[model samples]
Target chain A: MIQRPITVLMLSGLVLILLIGVTPAAAHGVEITYALTPVQTVRVEVIVHDLAGEPVRKADVTVFTPEVAPGDAPAAAEAELSPWLETSTDRNGWVSFVPDPALAGSWQIAVAVDDADAHITLPLAEESGLIRLASDQGISVMSSGLQVTVAATPITTIQVALHAQFDTGEAMDEAQVVVYAPDNPQDPFLTGTCDAEGRYAFAVDLGRPGVWEIQVRKAGHGDWLKIDLDENAIEFEEVPVDTAGDADSTNTTVQTVRLADEVARSVESDDGLSSGQIVLMSATTIWGFVGTALYFSRRRAATRPESESDN
Target chain B: MPRRFVTLVLIVLLLSSALIALAQAATGTLEFYANGEDFVRQGFVSKDGWAISFDHVYVNLTGITAYQSDPPYEPADEDAELVFDVEAILEGSYLVDLAEGDEDADPLLVGEVDAPEGFYNALSWEMVPVEDEESDMDGYTLLIIGTAEKDGEVIDFTLGIEQSYTYTCGEYVGDERKGILEADDYADLEMTFHFDHVFGDGELPPDDGLNETAPGFAPFAALAEDGVLVTDLAALEEQLSEDDWTLLVDILPTLGHVGEGHCHATLLDDVGETAE
Candidate 1:
């Protein structure tokens, strides 16, 4: 694996499950007590990527841990948050933080780049030697569900082939596909179904150059993609050109498609599946990826209580 | 041994579930903002080739609420009701100026509320006429004061609208995911306005969906006098051609959005009934 230089905010926030070493002769002789020491080292990894599954590197990452009153942590409502760590993402657009076992509470991370900002909150705590993350702050490490990945490939100047599939590498067969033209959003310009390979190819008349959207839905999940046709991408046949120069035409219409559960955009291309052909959707325009930051943590097994023999 | 293992597993499950429950029970601040985007803050050209610049654009909004939706909300879904676990409501109307800041300024804040910690994905807001009868902006939900120039002809214009709309939107999709409020942490949700929908963007292909539906500034420029045209939707409806007037009315409700995403804009009449 290639190691990219990403600034890491490692939060060592866990308790190492320790065995209870009790004195065997406590009933007849002197006894001793033990403290519940926090020794578990839990690491939370935050991955910030774009729709293309490419990492958004060099972005500034600011971590704000909830304020605790020394031994008496205030209630969530009365707590005032202060920045616990400030760092920038590495080349992989990721940061790693180990929760402060002493500070066992929620942590808020703000990753910013340019005009885009992604805030991810993870309620991390080291309790009873078990480290658990917030319910679901864009982290679904358990489910083997479908994750839709939309890729565009131009078949012709006006025609494009859009591919949709789960990150599990299964094609979204028979999924409903709806295309809405840039201007007429209320009505569908074209509607079709994906093949067994999750590919839906369609063609249209190039009357003008603008953004086009394709919404793909399967079962209860939905995902969408935006194709920006620029001047160099199409041949306009007797249509009025934009008089505002190329400045305004750069980003015509912005379409953001977030599906129901875990709106998956993680495209794992390791299975020989090609990815990031979105440039085929736009010639001059760059769809800057300002996406969600995923917070993930791997918990260790809890140690067994002391056996009777140890006592 | 199997029974003991099952009991231990059950206890762990209960403990973890309780921790998750405690995490979800926390509360946070959810900030709401109104953004005209660069299209209004910096101005743009109308589809008909008019370079426009704004001085002030005021909008009256009420019934602002955010929802923590499950199965998520899709505005494009027909008759889709927001199945939310919690809804954070800002219980008051507010008058906001979209063009109140510089080109690089942040969006204007509408208000903030103590909301449950969750992904407040879907949002809803209503645009009503200004309630103050004595103010110049009264009786209007939208007021636009701008200058449009095309082909050496300049027109100083103020477009006012008494029409009202209630926009129901899904999760905000833009440079980032919004409305994810952590305990004691704040997240922002925005109401984005696409003015290009009204006057058509001059920087796009003339046949683009947005420009095709918009009547552009050409029709409004025709209503100018002595390089000035200040009028309301009612006056423009009388002066503009039937097609242009109809298109203007169709575009006004669509002016509200959640970032680049569109909302289900329901036009309401004077009696707050859904207009035909």
Candidate 2:
């Protein structure tokens, strides 16, 4: 009986080991957190994660402080004087930065995983004096860094693949990607979830040849990236000229404005009756009155003569 | 009383009643007919000495009116409300295709109107293009399919024109041209459209003015035959130059001759009418 229990325990442990081996790792991403202390000093924290949700240790974090106010035209500042503050994440995937307590304007923080190509802009509000996330698509709050491209076209079949990443160049998993076709665009053509390596793909047969728009988004993110594709070309910019016919057909809405004003004005100005018209009008009126007078007089003459002859 | 006095009184009363009846208002059917019905059926010779026949001619005849006053009947103000007491003829789009010679297709209805029985000095018509989305047929405002042949050399031409024509009889009145509306009667306002005038002398633009070979119009033949054509206002505006487009729009309405396009009102009982 004891041997049987021991065998059952061994099998259970083996099944647990197999389960752990099969489970996917967390998606590669970055997270930044910040809080203000009672002393009015601000401390910013940065955390990096691998695809398996494990901490990514020793990633470099760079911080840029702005000389002007937040929400102002970035170009008007002319130059940023503050030197970049740099540090690396510790063993627990955490990095800390302390700004001068007297300096209280906006600050732009950036994180670089390894090389300068993989950099992300961390979210910080200049006025709120609080560190907040600008985007939730990946570790970085800025989603504008994502690059999208189409496969190929003449589009017998529609297929699109997206690589989700932060501005810092870290791959992001679990991001939502949706594809929309020209026809039935109100509904999604297909929806996909990113794999461990921060990649999502979709494919379907399309019926029409026109512009197809795809949207990529992450949870808690307000805005998403939009990509357009033409059936005849791999890129939207290379769309064929003949495809504009569909656009021509759609611009046929009825223009309710009357189209004859200019012609009427010209006719009126050139040949419309002026003084002669008045004479004709007077003639018509006089003739009408004359006819009435003649009728009344003839009736009176005939009636008077008849009455006189009878008397 | 003497018989002579009684007869005189009766005669006077009869004369007054007749005068009153003649002065009273009357209603009639204002009929519109094209002059080239027979020519459309049988091929007619063009001015270029070529035989030509039309396959279709569609026009939207709307906003018909008759004015009792003289010419220069206050230039039409599109935005102005209907203040002048003008007698309206047609209320909706009236289609007159000479090719469709069936019983149901003859004598297109202008409208049923009630007006004083007299001569209306001015008659006006507003002909706008047929829009595709609003119409069941092909969006061609005017589609003319014909063949011109000279010396055994044949040229098949198809022209689609989309333009709005607003014209009044003021400029077209001859010494005796007038429209008469009688009580419960049928009258034919014959507005004859001369296709020859459109392609007159086969000259190009700035020469013949409104010809098939005009810059914006020549492309219509090929596009229509290919079964991919839309001649809406915007399309024409885009295709034609400013001068050519303006020239075509200005000259098209003056194509009909006065007598050919004048009104000829007839009594309903005079002939048994065969109209739909």
Q: Each model's DockQ?
A: 0.01, 0.01
Off by over 4 Å in 1: A1-311, B1-25
In order, candidate lDDTs are 0.61, 0.41
- Interface Cα RMSD for candidate 1? 29.8
**In candidate 1, what are the lDDT values of residues B76-128, reduced to their tens digit?**
55545777767899989999999998998899999999877766768999999
**lDDT computed for candidate 1:** 0.61
Which stretch of 10 consecutive residues in model 2 chain A shows the poorest summed lDDT? A15-24
Cα error, candidate 1, residue A24 (Å) = 70
RMSD of each: 27.3, 32.2
Q: Work out the TM-score per prediction.
A: 0.49, 0.32
The CA lDDT at A144 in model 1 is 20
Off by over 4 Å in 2: A1-311, B1-29, B34-51, B71-86, B102-112, B129-140, B148-158, B171-178, B182-187, B201-250, B255-276
- Model 1, A1-311: lDDT tens per residue? 21321201011121122212111110001111111222333456666666556777767665555443332222321353324445666787666654444455766556667766555556665544334554433452111211111111111123355566543344667666666565554345545566566666544334434545466655323444544443112222221223321122222222322221112111111111112322232211211111110111111122223343366
lDDT for each residue of candidate 2 in A1-311, tens digit (9 for 90 to 100)? 23355333322221100000001111111221111111112344556655455665766554444443343323222353223344566787666544433244455444445432133333333332222333333344322322111111111232334455543444555655454454544344444445556655443343444333333334211112222223121221211112221112222221121112211121111122334654565456545655665566667767987899899
Worst 10 residues of 2 chain B by lDDT: B262-271
Question: Model 2's DockQ?
Answer: 0.01
Candidate 2: tens digits of C-alpha lDDT, residues B91-163: 6777666565543344344454565444343556655556557654344445666565557655565555554
